[model samples]
Target: MAKAMRTTPLGGTRQLRRWHRARILQAIRAEAGISRLRLARKLDLSPSVVTEAVAELLAEGLLVEKPLPPTGQGRPSVALDLEGECHGVLAWEIDLDRMAVALLNLRGEVRARAVLPPAPDSLSAALEQLQAATAPHLSGVRVLAAGLSIPGLLEPAQGHLTLAPNLGWADLPLLERFRAALEALGLNKTLAVVENEANAAAYGLYALGSLALEHCVYLSLGVGVGSGVVVKRSVYHGARFHAGEVGHISLDPQGPPCRCGKRGCAEAFLSLRRWQEAPTLARLGEMAERLAQLSAVVLATLDPERVVLGGPLVEATGEALLRLIQAKLPRYALSVHAPEQVALSPLGREAALLGVGALAADFFMEQMAYEEVS
Candidate 1:
């Protein structure tokens, strides 16, 4: 048998630093072309601290100073924005029977994108196909990082997949594979991240300005139902990296079993796969009542800023799902009747992919800061 390759990411300490730096960059990224003074004010930090941070970032080429016009008035203010040309972060969305890749500049604006052939039977095969599809686009432009969103228990720290139910991926070194692939293409310098598809979608919603409410909840209705929590504009991955595994939250101990070894999870009750098994269950005329029970639990318990429902089925059912949730919600669910905030994601299909792009770009900027500071 071939010796098992070291699947885990090398340099553990570097990975930790990269994560810390990513968080810092996320904070500084809110404003467009922010001035040093303005950033300090917005972030409520001392001017000296801001200057130090900005100076280091500028040295790293992560940030560039926007030209300030000559105004023969008072002191001119210098604006800082992301340096897009420095590197690009790619986001891959691996869905059922389809593979999509998007190229985003360091500022998180999408530059270009294309779809790849859905041709693979195993993890290695899929990565190979993805590499082939991404080859032409990988020329010259520094694709220094990638964020992969797939349906599975993704071990981000290790850049490995604990399990991918839909695609039969298990214990695969997802990040390292991408790294190797990029290196093969002569684009060697980069970071690779694997995130749960649902959590990624929630973070995507936050980045896109749709789920603007600081305290928001996102429900990703897919082969399995997954939910995400955003408190104060950040995605909390939790201690065990399973914080938002809401699909496995037990709604009934006697109901169907979730892939994670739980029974009667919200997913079991509302999973699209479950509906597919028995088409009659999904027909609007028949299962309306069951969908209501399942949806209402999430709405009433979370009582979030808004309950956003996405994923293909949710998008297809659309407002009908919203109405069911509203009808089931107690008349006194919240103070004096603000119309039910249940909504289908307007961003639709591209939401998860864009979210991963934003996250990877943010990570790249953070690494630059650490490099400059060090």
Candidate 2:
């Protein structure tokens, strides 16, 4: 006798539906031009569930389907991709020397970009410059949100920048100011997010799928040395949301003075200013050795898959410096960690801008999904 099989309905709760929608979008973004069947398989979701969620996304203009070429099969399939041309997020990186802005579409593509003059000394002047630089790009674009990456301690929860030594700014209400700037530009509905430049760069690398592993570290060497730690594809902000200040790690209590008012901190030894002053092989080797030492500490503590060296200094030095660091890392790191684990960033100076922009877009999409489900 044959046994009868029983099947349960695929109905899901609101939260589950929202999760499915978000996952579907993420999977599609990761593997752009993916087929619906492939998306369902990748996410381990029922075909009906994916179809329903995708239908909602399509109606909301968040996704689009492109027809695939005939393969001599029963029926041709359609590929899914983000509706990138219609929506975007504004991303900004405010450094001590300059500010860069970019418009990132839903597909994580930079549709437009511009580099503004150095940030002004006062907060009000900086805001005016930012508005002027950003307004020209937003004429016809639907901006979902904005992301700001600053080089210093950022209390994101409070929207405050506790300190930016290179810029000589402290206790600035960054988020409030940015929001006001957006409102003044007639974008009152857009959301804004602020993060440390190093953290944003790390997240940007993660979002770009540059590394296979979920955990990694980004060492940003610019006017100052900073590091961003990512664990499981998320930035690891410590108890006060100010983790990854690796620059302040006192390597030698009697070493050179750092801008952060600390002596012998890693930044004092490794800041780009110091390297630029003496761009010689011996100095490069010293910088690489010190960076390798710092990286070794990072590896032992976080045990990330790799430590990515980035920022203006690394871009200027290129692979020559990376080779030195790779050669020296093993001396301080554990036997299990290989020298090859240290690598150079491919994104260069644009890492923070792109990273924060992608984050802002993802946040907007997630919030939209939640609202629909709720």
Candidate 3:
């Protein structure tokens, strides 16, 4: 005779249920229009568990079921998708020359986006302009959180901009300012986050449909060159949150000086600002080769499954630069097999904003589960 299975507390069971629901919801967002049966197989949860969790999500208006045409199935398959217009996040990117604000849905799709003026003199000024610009599109929706991306090293935990040479900002308490602005705008309940622009863009590419690998590196080449490494489908911030400072990687001992006070750093040669200053075919090729060298270093160390080139420079050079990088990769890759393929980001300038949306969406989902279990 077998002993009876141990029973968990009623509250524990409800918590488990909420966790399962969160996972199912996440899968639905990742692979929009995924069937429950497929989600069960992918997430390795029992069909009954998925059914129960999905049912709850449907009731909560976070998910919707769409009927799929049968392909020799018993009943028409119902695919789960994030409910459009249910809720969204506010994502902002403050760069050297511009500030972009976007509203993204649960599936990381941009519902509305606005490119405001250049970086403002103060955080408050930027917030005021952003609020006025996005006011028309901000009504009738629950905003889960606000995410801000900046081109600088940041104390992310406190949302402080520690250093941004291009923008001439230092030790700016952006997160605190953002929270205060939200309170002033009567949006006190919305959470706020601040992150490095490159890291956010890398995470955005991973969370969005841009990359399909568990590990990939995103090279952001704007006023500077930085990298974001995604391991296990999450951004890998190093011990000091400077994991991918590829920009400062010294390339030439006697090369031009970088803002970080390094000579011959990759950013000194490959940055968009540098390219713009010396726009010539020869310079473009040199920059492209340097980019390839950076990619080689990434492959040699991190060995990610894919490498992505992004930021303002990539957009400017487009296919010409992409081909140069690809052509030069074989020489530097030093791999027995073909090197990891490098691709341009589909998210373009909006990558950071979408990335914040991805983070905010996940945070909001976890918040939902917490509220339910509590």
Candidate 4:
């Protein structure tokens, strides 16, 4: 399958060193205040390689040395952290009810954030207002890229939306509109990305420095039921870029109609509005049943190391829903092999925005490495 947001291949010995340098920087970000010895151990690299990478990062002003805590033995260790406030990225999320914009520092801390005044009637109007609200935060900030999360079908690399049923938009050239808005505000140097909201959320959780899972499934239950799958450190985008449209997975062939002109799709049953207005026992049972079935499918098909349930529904229900979903997984699975761990997203409502920010951060680091090699 053709991948989304493909990275270029490394060439020759020097380029490979640059790639290793980038990986070292990411390791430092993941384990802040980590010593070179632990970094080499964690990344499975030699001590000399870690030392060389640390030196290059120090020269590039991306790392800062920290005084090691007392070891009470041998030689004192040296710890390193991401340099403070070197740069930042802008991350935006457009949901059904509202839109959010956040400015994140290099270390993924939010420096500034704001919720836009609801979503505008048109994509153009929404982009204009979002840009205006975001301009003030951009003052004196070097924004390397802008990450956009859309709650619909998207061409990630190009920021094009083929359809956003909730937004009443189809075939919208979102990146073009976003770029024009940025240009109007003279923020032309900032790179822009458009991606599916669920996908962004999945990546955001994956980028959390604490969690060390290699494979994860992020189920987003908001206006619709969607999922993002991450294998290793990258998102798995099927050839058609519709890999994780789990919302469209039909639960019944004879139930209610779906936006995709299908009957008894998962989206129809899992609508957050339906659950909120009349959350009867029967409704809750059905929700749990569908979720278990979906989780089982995920495990049988992908066998993710863990499954993370996130988005508005989980935010509202907290661990209650997580417990329910966990309870139902074993009963509904088609096979005996099931993931032992399933939980709620630690990133909470900020997963999508933070995910896009993480995406931008990785892209910026990659670009920097390529430049160094050149």
Per-candidate alpha-carbon RMSD to the true structure: 7.1, 5.9, 5.2, 3.6
> After TM-score superposition, what is the CA distance of residue 96 in candidate 4 from its true location, in Å?
0.7
Most accurate candidate by lDDT: 2
Residue 281: error of model 4 in Å? 2.7
Q: Which residue pairs overlap in candidate 3's backbone?
A: none
Which lDDT tens digits does candidate 1 get at residues 1-374? 00111122235655534433343355556666667777667656578767776776677666678756656888888878766764578888787646788888765677778887653677667767777767767665777678888877776767777877777778888778867876776767777677777767777777765456655667787677767666666666778777666677676799778767888777777766655666562454333444455455555665667667788667656677667666654542544323456677766877778878866765665454344332
Give the poorly placed runs of model 4, Cα more than 4 Å off. 1-21, 35-61, 69-78, 338-340, 370-374
lDDT of 3 at 325: 85
TM-score of each: 0.75, 0.91, 0.88, 0.86
Question: Global lDDT of each model?
Answer: 0.66, 0.83, 0.79, 0.78
TM-score-superior candidate, 3 or 4: 3
1 or 2, which is superior by TM-score?
2
Best-first order by TM-score: 2, 3, 4, 1
Q: Compute the lDDT of residue 136 as modeled in candidate 4.
A: 84
Per-residue lDDT of 1-374 in model 3, one digit per residue for the tens?
00111222245777778667767777777688899889999988899998888888888777888899889948889988888784788887788768988888888888989997788776667778877776777778778788888888877776777787777778788889877776766678897777888888888877785466668888988878878888876778789877898888987889999877779999889877777888888988999888888888888888788788888898888888988888888888867425437888888878887887777776676654554455
Candidate 2 regions exceeding 4 Å error are 1-17, 369-374
User: In candidate 4, what are the lDDT values of residues 50-128, reduced to their tens digit?
Assistant: 8998898898777889779777987789989987565678888788767898889777899899887657778888887
Rank the candidate models, highest lDDT first. 2, 3, 4, 1
Candidate 3 residues lying further than 4 Å off, grouped into runs, are 1-11, 34-52, 66-78, 337-340, 369-373
